[model samples]
Target: MIMPQQSSKNSGLWQQATLLPIALVAIEILVINGGMILDMTTSGTSDATRVLLMDSPHWFLLTGLVLGASEILAYRFLVKRFAKRPVTELGATGCIKETALGILVGSVLVSLPMLILWARGFWRFNSFAINSGILKGIGIGLIACVFEELLMRGVFLRLLEQKWGAPGALVVTSLVFGAIHLSNPGVTWLGALTIGVEAGFLLGTAYLWKRRLWFPIGLHFGWNAMQAAFWGGNVSGTGKQSGLLDGTLHGPTWLTGGSVGIEGSLLTAVIGLLAAGVIWKLTPREAPEMAPHEAKTPTDEVPDTGETPAITASEPGRQTRRD
Candidate 1:
């Protein structure tokens, strides 16, 4: 069908603004349906019940990976065609560093909260084990981190910030992030709120600080991975799986997080805010004054002197122009 025409600026702006939510919904549908098909065909489930109850990790990984690729392709298309921007700034080296820092920051933020609970005698160690589930869990974490960050931080936050500025975007995205988890099996209002205040702002802030998805993705992956793989905790009310450590909670549901995991606890909020503050402070500040000092063009960088304006060992007393 033919579409209404719009100015170039408005067209680009709208495309940059709204494509993320569309992409999110599209990916979810594709992943869910694709997983169902794989499960039904491979698991010999001839009925709807089996499809709905599908839990095979193989199908999950296959669907997640395929859809993850699709999401990236979609992102590239939007960025190049509609947004009219280069994808080069998503530098490989920078992504790795940001992701690693995110993981480290997330690990510390999440662990500290749980550790506080443990210190208060709200948690206990019950058992310990490791299995193939850990790999599956990691795969799930990877997919979740990449996709969620792409949607929430990379796209949603960017658009929102453009329209509403940082504070508005931060709150909106954070609340949305928490709201999505409300459908989790045992999530309570308080739990969801805690998630909003803690993870929502924390991850969004991580993205805002670095202006890259990798950092938030790493933070997200590390947070879920630690909760699932390391602690064997129920993530967002999902039942716990085999992890490196099998543990138990022993205090009020509010303090220990009951089955919803430590993310539902009060301590998480405090630590999350602290981590966000640290990340905000650590981000490199832009040297705005350097902009005016830069050469107007490549040719303007040098003088007629035999030597370029660049300082060198041979010109000990000579000074280079600041620009």
Candidate 2:
């Protein structure tokens, strides 16, 4: 009988990682059940209420917003309870800038493979048009990203990083990400495996490197938006709307990604892996050090002891009090 080694590091990793999937399921259940109830009450129909509440652009946007808000609140609450510092590390304040960067990175990376396929005669662009639906797509993209990123990167990867380090966290998060998509329409073992290899690592690393949700959230949103809403490609085989550039894949299914879309192609996997490598290199070798006692916001300096603070961060050259 071999006894398992009782290393603290491995123990910590398992503990933290274990909590992530459970937490994710809880959040999804709350959101889905809550959304269903809201829909049935408002629409006076419980038949297929889940679909009725979540099957449109407006619903996507609304659900994303609601989920995003809940995620933020939950994150802050968890951090306050479990971690030693404030929730500023999540980049809640610099959201707009981080999201913009994520969108840019995600769009460029996701498009590169498509462009290559098109140039190589493996894919073709046919009907091209921009319409009102694009707006809905963008909205859906923004909100949907918030929910996914909040779970995968912001919660799961972030917590895992504290215990397993970046490499381990990246691997775990990516595998889980891909596994969850197995239930999506038209997904094969190859498709699921490639998705794990291509997107799981990329998105997880984005969060690991940045230590912020915005970058990965943006990337997640931008990738789907470009693939499904822009190129009219199938997204995880769920089908997409007639997008800005309706196209057809002309070559082998291996190259063209078949019905599962570009993400299923080996080309996408290679490109995504390369992009992940670049992101890893660009990310700090180690996390930036937080001050022993630091302020999360300017208002954090205000004294609550019935005394006016002498110097706020607003005051020039004022030294913060040390703990």
Candidate 3:
């Protein structure tokens, strides 16, 4: 029923959609596995020594640094080669301020739910202490938050937006993000769904708000580090050996969020969605004018400002010359 040219066009479109994401993921996996192998080799043949090294906060910090640098280089290479755009998402300008704001927002969102649960007598703190666990938590959070934001927002969401527009891209990315966590220990269907909806929109809107990766990365790191290391709660479904504050929840799984931490709570969902809405409202409707000194590619008719174009429901497939 289809003409050869039309069928070929469809096939090309499909390949275009699938290729970059697949390649990026593959590169990431290879980097991670290679790092693991390197760590094992350096730690020597004894299982005990390897385990000890792996658990050390210093080691985690070292690994995070290595992995972070590697990922950034890989991301920059891919974006430059395939997307033919400047790597402005990882721009250093105002990064500290944006990241700090994100950390504050994330801490507040997590705190509100815990405060409510405590007020209602559903939760209680057992103890407070500071330990190396906090450092380890920071290391883990840095690596994870950076890696995920790069892969999800930097790569997947950006590419999808090019094809499906912002709204459709957000929805698709959110679902995929949630689905990816189904394999995490202790995650339920409900838990994964909550993550998809709350985190997806929250992170996506953060990118839309500033058109940079720092805010979302800081937000993610703050949430996970606070929940697991500071608050003494499970993260996703996995429990750490220790946290700064030892706490217990005595309530329904729905209210307590069970093993998935506060991320699974209804209160968190409500608050996260509210925050996302506020961010969406605050997002600029149009890209700001670029400074005259800003870098421009030879192929660009207009300077690439790295800002997301104004999204409209009616033009889901509209193409723009800028990133």
Candidate 4:
């Protein structure tokens, strides 16, 4: 049986592990809804006009900004109170460069499979046009990727690592992340599993390799935004999206990913897994340093007389005796 003190300690640790993610989710929902309600009340337009305005690129961009700010503030406050470590993951140093690299990587990952489909005659493009929908996709992708990376990589995975180490934490977080997407509009069991394995490993390794959030955030945003911008298809089963290219996908559900978009395709999963392996190999193997409070103290050495010896600075070879 566990002792009372041990049980209490375990309970405290569990709370510490869980509280931040839950609070962050709560803050996100509250802010998003609050923004919507405030918009609805202040617009004073007809119902149809209000709906159109809410769907506009400007509205989404504004919401993304507000929501991103609120989540960041909450994350900072919670980490300072509980983890007691500097928020290095969200540090601004090299963020732009790293994020740009991530975007390029993400675009490549999604592009390869889509290109394969197109070459096989499963996907066809009709025309191209510049439109506001691309901007809207950008806004949606920004909000989603930032919110997810902050919660998943910044808090949940990091906390789990404290107890389970990196490997175990990666596994748990991947499974949980995939499970969360199971509720999406067209996601199937296989799709969810693939997401858990593919995205989980890809994003998780990205974080492990760099020890920063910007890379993974940019990667995620690039994937979703590119899907909407180029293909005019569903992204992660979020439903149809407007894109700059007028196109249609026609093929077996397994090959084309059907309503779930390219993420559900077997080819995408294979490519993503390979990419994840490459990232994992590049990741450093060293464990992160312990927080100051969590570091172990060195035991003092005592002689047979049960007195600790201290070296004297004044004498090169002398030991000081304690009274």
Highest-scoring model, lDDT? 4
- Pick by TM-score: 1 or 4, better one: 4
Cα-based lDDT for every prediction:
0.73, 0.73, 0.75, 0.80
Error of 1 at 249 (Å): 1.3
**TM-scores of all predicted structures:** 0.78, 0.75, 0.79, 0.87
Better of 1 and 3 by lDDT: 3
**Residue 245 lDDT (model 3):** 86
lDDT of 1 by residue, 1-323 (tens): 33332254456667766875587668778776765566657766566756444555555556566766777777777777766666542546687788788788777777887777778777787877776666556656666777787888777787677668777888999999998888989888888988888889888878777576777878998898778778777887887766787778777877877667888887787788777777768756532111122214465455666765555454678765643
Better of 3 and 4 by TM-score: 4
Indicate the worst ten consecutive residues by lDDT in candidate 3: 288-297
Give lDDT tens digits, candidate 2, residues 188-218: 7788878999999898878867687778888
TM-score, cand. 1 vs. native = 0.78
Sort by TM-score, top down from the best: 4, 3, 1, 2
Misplaced by over 4 Å in model 1 are 1-6, 39-54, 284-323
Off by over 4 Å in 2: 1-24, 30-35, 42-54, 287-323
Of candidate 4, the 10-residue stretch with the lowest lDDT total is 294-303
In terms of TM-score, which candidate is stronger, 1 or 2?
1
lDDT of 4 by residue, 1-323 (tens): 98564555455456656887788778778866765786657766677777787778877767777777788778777766766667788777898999999999998898899899889999888878888878777777777888888878877787677788889989998888888888998898888878888888788888888778889988998887788766666889888778787788888888888777788888888888899899989988877655444544453233377765654655677667643
Model 3, span 278-313: residue lDDT tens: 998998865422222233447536667897676445
Residue-level lDDT for 124 in candidate 3 = 85
